[model samples]
Target: MKFQTFKVCGLVFAFLIGSAFLGSSGSALASQKVPISFNDYHGYTGTVKYIKSVAKAYPNITKLIEIGKSNMGRPIYVLVISNMKTGTTIDTFVKLRNKRKEGVKNVPPMKPYQGKPGHWICGSTHGNEYTGTEVCLYTIDKLVSGYGSDKEVTRLVDGQTFYVCPVVNPDGLYNSIEKGISQRQNSMKKDDDGDGKVNEDGYDDLNGDGHITWFRYKDPKGRYVIDDVDPRLMVRLRRNAKTDKQLYSVIREDRDNDGDGERGEDSERGIDLNRNFPEGWWKTDGMAGGRGNYPTSAPEIHAIAEFFTNNTNILMAQNYHTSGGFTYRPMGTAPPNQLHPKDVAIFDMIMGKKYLEIIGEEVPEAWKAPGSLARFKEELEKKSKNKYAIARGYELPRGWRASYNEARDRRYGYGMASDWMYMQFGAYAITTELWNPQKDIKDFPQFTGPDARIEAQRALLKYQDEKYGGKLFIPWKKFEHPELGEGEIGGWIPKYRSNALPGEPLLNVCEKHWQFELFRAGLQPEIVITDAKARVLYTANKANSAVVSQKGDLVSIKKGKSKGKYKIVEVTAVIENKGKLATHVARGAQLAGNREDIVWLIGDRDKITHLQGTKFQKLGVIEGTQKIPGYTGRPGAGPAEQRRMQRMPRFIPPGYPMFFRMRGARLEPTQVKQTGPKREVRWLIAVEGNTPLKVVVTSQKGGTKVKNLLIQ
Candidate 1:
């Protein structure tokens, strides 16, 4: 033991939300946890402006950053929330959760938890999946209002950073919101089919309704038929000689727009922003824009790719999608066996089961009005009399079991952003497919058939009767078509029955997602400087002791025969990993393109070596969660990972305490194991009165920790 040092070790709070602190808690100047409802869900532009308003209202902890512009020149916004302090002070001390005797088994007490990681969240990757925009606004609202007031919120703001990009595809998201038609991609100029043409024709709200829903009509020989159990539900008509029910083919509400021999197949801006990431990008030819000509082809995606690449401390990320109501984890293209063996356990049981329970609890069940079923039957009969043709869309998500990977859903999606983040940067990525109507239906419904969309259709019908007085169901109306001749166009309003929730009770559902997201962020590795101190070594008096030759600037000696003393001090600190997961994920460590952060001792420049293992990167502060530099200013070269070391091999187990010395006089170092957490150990060095021995530790997810001590 040297000079007495007081260490304020934060008792790593495992709970993310609804947590109470027993400390010197402070209140935020202007903070309130006000709930923003979906009375009229904020569309893309509205959501963007709302985020800005939140940042303005909470200028101390929030900043509205424009990352880049969409293809259609829509500004991409990322709301950054933090304590807004740039410099470190004595009060900005390291709270190494348990830097003292309570050091966990694996990691050591030599390194302190450095900085809080940035938690990345975004929604509306698929423009038509409108719920994401709302979720983003809701998240912004949470961070803005909860900054210093809410205990959990204060912790996240002061400790960790939050990045919320509400609408990744702003143009398309707003188009879907305003026009009831979302091209599902940015309004870019690209000939999707390479048809020597560009975005000529596709999709039309022919009925003058605000949605491009199903264009259903009777066909003697069609590929789909109305389900016998639920007349409102459409099912695939499998081949069978005995079954003579008429089949129908439902097309998009359009005719042959481009005259490309395909009906409403190609549209302008056919890029799938989600499928334009830099990881595992391959031309699937399975779906349009499934694989852009090159990775990060979309400007929005490019901005996001570079934004994350420039930031290495992001701990976890969630990409919100819709309708499936399932939590999807990585190895997007790889099957369970193809990925790290441990990933299955992480994805299936931990991720799936936990979120399943949470979502099940958050969203309520659908209420069918009494006698609505009889009206539904009458409506079904009237539609049946019309003998309208039935058609099916097979590619939709159907079976939603706890671990329903979309029923053999293993294509790794050519350029899915989720997979890109996980595979390229080792970021813990999750695709949260929101809102499965069946999940809200009575009996806790399960997708028994190949596709459970029909059950969702049934639930929607019931919801319409109960919520909207059966108005959601549009009666089949005749429409003369140039290509398909006389036909009818009528069906459910895609936006009405889709993931969009109408009332406030479902507001809880939106809030519950935040619960899950915050929970995941709590897993960020935190290395706390549990204890730190410095001791004075023997002071050599120049007048009495023999003058020793100095080996460099380790210790400077005064003139001989002089009444002077040379003092040397030793410094040490206790460090512990408070996060549940390892500092860096296994996959992230093995990827060359990912960051391999290390701990370093900052002493006299002459005493330290800039060798490969003992290198130094001056990450002065954990300003990771703030606005990304060069976001809007820089012209993105391409995907950020392209500039990374994608083939490098490096990995360190959680809590690995490495050793280093800023040498002055050669001395034996403390003995310890090759790697893994270590108990307090002494450093051999020379120092003048009160020398500042600073130690900086860094983990990809834990941000950075810089602590200094004075020794005399």
Candidate 2:
């Protein structure tokens, strides 16, 4: 689809333009220019009408497919951009293949049979992960407009199809936008703090500065004190290094609206999207971080899950977040010993290498998490015997220099997304923390990079403050709280503080990360036709009557070197498949299948069955090994038995790799090797062929390369 390039504009101007374009089209659209400024990024509200605006602008290329609806009745629009023809669905290809399988050989090839794998990009599963939404929108704009123009972009798009959902949590995202609050939960309105009442009271704009910031008050028993090193930052008071008995504490508003003493004692939401995943989902109250009674409780999460279930062609996945600098990979809850050695090695290579190039740091090994998408991927591989390498949780650095503890925002937990993906899908999955607030500091080393701009954050903050009338920030002010009467409530706004960098610098950061994401998409698992040919073997007939019929089905006899030529099938074909798993868990009657339909086959003249090799299984099989029609059925379960199968653990033998896809990065299989002294460290390397391609190496000592090999 063609996208109109938008010129940069103020947030207010951008909102007006975007709103005006909503659900309208025709000659009036000719003069419309989309504003591409930082304000424009934040102004997006994910409205259905706004989707129509995007559609109208790129009528030829943009398509609004309603994958599902959110809990608040918001349509989950999937904006698909590709040069491939429409009305060409994966179903169509499947149906055609079934028809071909039913016919005999020596028949004309299925009329115009053409099929291609696809790639997926999703955003905003967490309500507070807003940067991903903007970055995704920007990516859509770039891809649609740059198609047939930009060489790299064009190659990526044309060679592979793209499915993008700008906002996975429409209700949460829109609610927060409307309320001007940075709420991480969905719109279920439960008691989060668990004081009493449901969402009765949350962090308020006590200072009226359009932000929820830390509020420190003077108390005789306070435990915090300003750090002598940096007053701008906070530090825990040392036990023996105090003079006065003054006490300090960070406080927000009370939860109960009726001035009740209880805080958010009764305000809890339905579930945390990240924790709702099926893998390692514990039944504890806070196990899944507010995961509802069961998986897929929220409509938004369900919709996302359904989309991934249907689109099995997707092999690579990427989910964007913010507030951290590290890139993490799967096996979240699994102990280091339980982690697949090969998978760990691969993750270290891809993530470690990328981190060094982008953030100039090495990803740390060994972190634990549960109920994550990474675990789901691991389960998928175990269930389907498909080697789907999925990665989740790309965490951006919370503190730019790693020494700022308060700056460590969990909003961008790298280990969460990366580890989940590696466990679920054999393909790649990554969660990139889009922006870092520390990067906004003028003297930050990142500003000196090739893509850096002078005082970018200052320019963005100035623009946002002026355009929004400071409604997007928190100005210093005092308020009378029931808990702490007469205390200053002003600190840092959600978007203006330590969580996110200034929008202007953030845009550049997003662009650079998006480039890396594009590179990641290129690394998704692909299939190639290494060889194809037919050969005839002659054997001696049981009875040497005359010359035995060489064409006999069994015991055919053709003595004395028969004059026959063998056709050597040789062609190089790259198969690109990007997959996505919407939510980690399934809800209601629907269970996201453990296997995606990424398979390849080579058949003979009979055509009754074809040799099959899939991303899940490294080995290939001859046709007719199984009686299943499309090879879509689960192993050990017959067609009739599969219908009655419940959501229980199923065993899958080795050689078959299962796959799953989600919002974030794509993952692929890699071999792991332990080298160096004591073999205490392990490295992950990508496997291209029989040969091993070194990606990462680890050691007891910290350094760049190990024995000439990079150890990122």
Candidate 3:
């Protein structure tokens, strides 16, 4: 119930120490509907419970979806946060041609939230790296809790869609936390050859302490020595360091359960989920560069791929990992040249700069002076051997970097989710390694130099002792190993060792990442029908009685020779992208299954005939109002370039095919195009009687919006 205030880099942070921070409602004492605590880690069971509660408590804004199942048959859940009734899609208005009487269920109906721009955030791709799970849960708590109480949150919840998948690898999280086994990869039930001869030499709690901690024994060839400052900690020695201290061999608190004389040989561990995506999965040598026989071979990765396939509205994607407290943008498999310069600007100068600031890291000098990039690029070309770095004008900072090994000029890994999402799906995707004890922990001592890791470990032990009463660590105790003569069974608990320490430290990590994602969400493109009106240029009892022609601002109508009840109406609509980023990234529309933003004029199809513009007009990519920092490249394609049409073939009367073709009138479709953040579209149509009209704008990644047109 007590609140404490502190400052990090002059920005004051207020957090509740003993209990979880109650989400916003009115006052500090207001009870949170779905109260959540970061006091300790929430494994799969707890996470599922909390998310389900949020979905039930906030039914209007939240829907819990089981996207798919893991290898262990555990459901992978994605909690969607958005107003369920506020949005609409192009499918609702546009009628398709050649519809079949018996419908095939190839594609499911688009949900209302799909009509809005989507931001996807998932955590725990690796089982042992479950710190991201806590952050994901924390983000969900902030969003659902702050919905009606906070202004910015309210606007976001009402306007945009947020897909939060708290646990991408459910079995890994369960095993890591609940079973106390540090499983980095997901769990698989099958063996290598599917012969049911699964290896069972997984880590066993030999000490019966209910924790799969480390066991250390004396050995001349041991690679670890007791820390001078903290005896409870064991520090690893350098490969060739000659230390005069007693050496110790350390292993997980496990024994040969199957009497195979080997430990953890064939555990339930599956392939690395991050290395199971579809981008750069095959090497140039025709070898499988990624894990598994092919991309998405793992069940967990398959679910993620399928979910992304169905949700094309997602433009911003984040896959969370642990321990490093840094971010990896995209193109990890390829070089920086693979990314468009404009995207690079947005990723580095915009998102990267903000991330470094949030984590209290120094922003690169070149990033601050984006206008001086030309000079920086020149400087890099002369001094740096990394061509990608030279092209980007600066090397990526430690806090925000690509996983690709730029120094060695080599790929980091294959089938990375971020690379797949960006190159193939055209999303602004990134993988953020969450938690850094040095940065996230308030007032933790700064460790540097050769022995900095040992020093940091000592500080963390002391901090946990003072703050958490030392329960976080298990004191080393001598135990008689069933196989070895003697050893001590103790060390930091598996999950607590590498992840963000519980309570304030974990909360701090969660807050910083939530803020970053919130900022990213704010950048999603928002398409809107700003202004729309239908003007009745001419009206007559019969369609042939009125033919319309425009000269300057004046319109003249004369008797014509077409058919029926006619009213020549001119519909003008102003479409704009009011959000921060453009409707799509560079070349995003050209990606398969993606298209340029389109505006549709809807009415009774049978009654209205388009005399000028088509019923639906391609708006191309509607530029956003926000200017991208550090990017001076050409903007996205404007309406004029996007709406270009081929010349219509001259129409020839049916009966007099060749002889009378010269006397026949030539006909062509009319189109009006404009550019930039806004477009003015005009359509001349003949309406039979007084047909109601509406204008709808649809963008694959931007969002869909509609405005009813009133005929005057």
TM-score of each prediction: 0.71, 0.57, 0.88
Q: How accurate is candidate 1 locally (lDDT)?
A: 0.60
Candidate with top TM-score is: 3
Local distance difference test values of all predictions, in order: 0.60, 0.45, 0.85
lDDT of 2: 0.45
Best by lDDT: 3
Please give, for residues 215-313, the per-residue lDDT of candidate 1 as tens digits: 766777778787888666667765763457777777768867777677655565557787778765764554444556688878888889877865666
Candidate 2 segments whose C-alpha is farther than 4 A from its true place? 1-34, 40-52, 86-115, 189-198, 206-215, 226-245, 283-290, 336-345, 362-421, 437-442, 445-475, 525-712
Off by over 4 Å in 1: 1-30, 33-35, 86-115, 192-197, 226-236, 239-246, 256-266, 283-290, 341-349, 360-412, 441-456, 504-508, 541-565, 593-597, 603-681, 688-691
TM-score of 2: 0.57
Q: What RMSD does model 3 have?
A: 7.8
TM-score of 1: 0.71
lDDT of 2 by residue, 16-109 (tens): 8887666233323332334244444452364445556766776555667787776566677888665544223223223343343334532223
- For candidate 3, which ten residues in a row score worst on lDDT? 638-647
